[model samples]
Target: MTVRAVRRTSLVEQAVTELRRLVEGGEWPVGSRLPGEVELSRLLGVGRSTSREAVRALIAAGQLHSRQGLGTFVASIAPVTDFDRQLRRAELAHIYEVRVALEVEAGRLAALRRTRADISALRDALAAREQARGAAELVDVDLEFHRAVVTAAHNPVLTDLFATFLDAVRDASTEMVADQGPSPEDHKHDAHAALVQAIEDSDPQAAMAATRHNVEHTLAQLRPERP
Candidate 1:
């Protein structure tokens, strides 16, 4: 297991924060250059080195950029919103509910009618996931597997509904995988293999059970633990 590092704040951080506010507050307008080093130092009442460090900090923070001779300018006036702030608990709750409803039906249909080509696609997806280089690649291939399941069901509405939540679903999966850390993520593949076998045998009840089990287990993993 890896231990996360404890970080110590530095004066450069304060400089970065102050400079960010100055630019974001429109004291330095978008596309407008800041005063030269000497002038900025006089205005901010800081030494040349301190002002330079502050400027560099702002650049790294995405607030400003410096040209060799043209000097530092505000890059943009875009307002940044944290995704964490916008994400609602209820929305996440509903995502799982929707998954359970859609996937159970998809699993049933996949068992009844999955073609040889459909089985091949699912196998390819699992293979790609097994060979995934990083969390991003794993998430991509994992999504492909789920999408293949939906597609194999031969229901256009189910496929379209799954596509609608694809982005958020990807984000949620990425977050969980990152928190859980690394593959072979402990029997997850086994669960998928069971579902595949059910589908191959054309056993609707068994396929539905396997799909529901996987989704419910994912929901449990997503819940916060009590202290």
Candidate 2:
């Protein structure tokens, strides 16, 4: 085999690549502060300007964020693209619309493919939801129940995409509990029980219906005047 000539990268580009590696490898986790420009320049054996350029590039890419006096910190290993930022800023109702789409499919697939362990996890989550006494706890437990359902579907890509909306979903759940006062009409434990039973029995149509009812009930409560 003939040896090919290796292409050379600029110092700033190499620094960017190295910094990205450290962040992605968990050497620098989110919210962890990165070294100052002087120290980074020394460590990376580059000029301070090069280090600054690399850091600025990462900040623009959303991998790092700089505070006025607090220094630079890792924002996310997975850079927040424009599309992701838009999703993060979306209204709760719009977020839930996407959630309903994801979960309806997740429920259907879970009913068809869930293992005994998945069923057990779902049961545990629902039991925890029943026992939750406070709004915060109830919201958490409810999300856990839904998360278990998605996980049971055994699709990694779907699971990851669903996870990205979890914070928004949790916020919406908390708002629902706070506004509706956690009554039977608000929490809808009976509907949740029906969903668990449907999943346990491996009934796809029942599972989808139950999931849709849960989503639509919350949407109706949130937007009662919607036609």
Candidate 3:
């Protein structure tokens, strides 16, 4: 079989990917100066423009920074890979446990900090979730509603943290939703609705309960034989 030809984008993407791997793997630790563009092009075996673009992408990702007189330098070490890899490998139960701990607090904070705009976004996300007719659509909308709740907390770190592993959450949700098979097109979810209501009412404990209630229902279905 013949291998597909690589495009210019694939070239730059791999270059950036390799750069991130080097940085995250500690080969190129934080504050260390990166090799010059000429050297980087040589190392990555690509054109100078390709390496330049790769560096620009990493700079945008907050992994690297450039100085006027000096070359590029590692800005910060994103410890995203190792932990995220483990998280991806984790079982559904373990992932759900993490989700509950994280989201319960998010819901509590959201209840306290939600603005009117936040509420509108939550309603829209929940509505989309309710209206989802396909499993893929449901998986996306489910996470979208949860993301709206996390956003309502008004915590940048919380929102960034959730966004970091959102794909993992989506993968788990896809499997779980697909496992349960098809849901009725007209059926609506009450647990998430309860969550939205609790947040709307500014009731922190109720929000936490609603968040836990929603997760527990899914976890319960997964462990059907539990007493």
Winning candidate number (lDDT): 2
Cα displacement (angstroms), candidate 1, residue 70, comes to: 34
Expressed as tens digits, the lDDT of each residue in 132-194 for candidate 1 is 665556666777877888999998988988887776675555445544554354336778777
To one decimal, what is the Cα RMSD in angstroms of model 3 from the true structure?
10.8
Show the colliding residue pairs in model 2.
Answer: none
Give per-residue CA lDDT, model 2, range 164-201, as digits (tens).
77766765564445334565754668888988899999
**lDDT per residue (tens digit) for residues 8-119 in model 3:** 6578789988998999999998899999889989999998877876776666455776765567889878733544433433466667777888899999999999999999
Q: Residue 113's C-alpha lDDT in candidate 2?
A: 94
Error of 2 at 131 (Å): 0.5
List candidate 2 stretches off by more than 4 Å.
Answer: 1-90, 224-227
lDDT of 2 at 189: 85
Candidate 3 residue 45 C-alpha distance from true site, Å: 35
Q: Judge candidate 1 at residue 144 and give its lDDT.
A: 81
RMSD of each: 12.8, 17.3, 10.8
Task: Write down the TM-score of every candidate.
Answer: 0.59, 0.59, 0.57
Which candidate do you rate higher for lDDT, 1 or 3?
Answer: 3
lDDT of model number 1: 0.71
Report residue 119 deviation for candidate 1 (angstroms).
Answer: 1.3
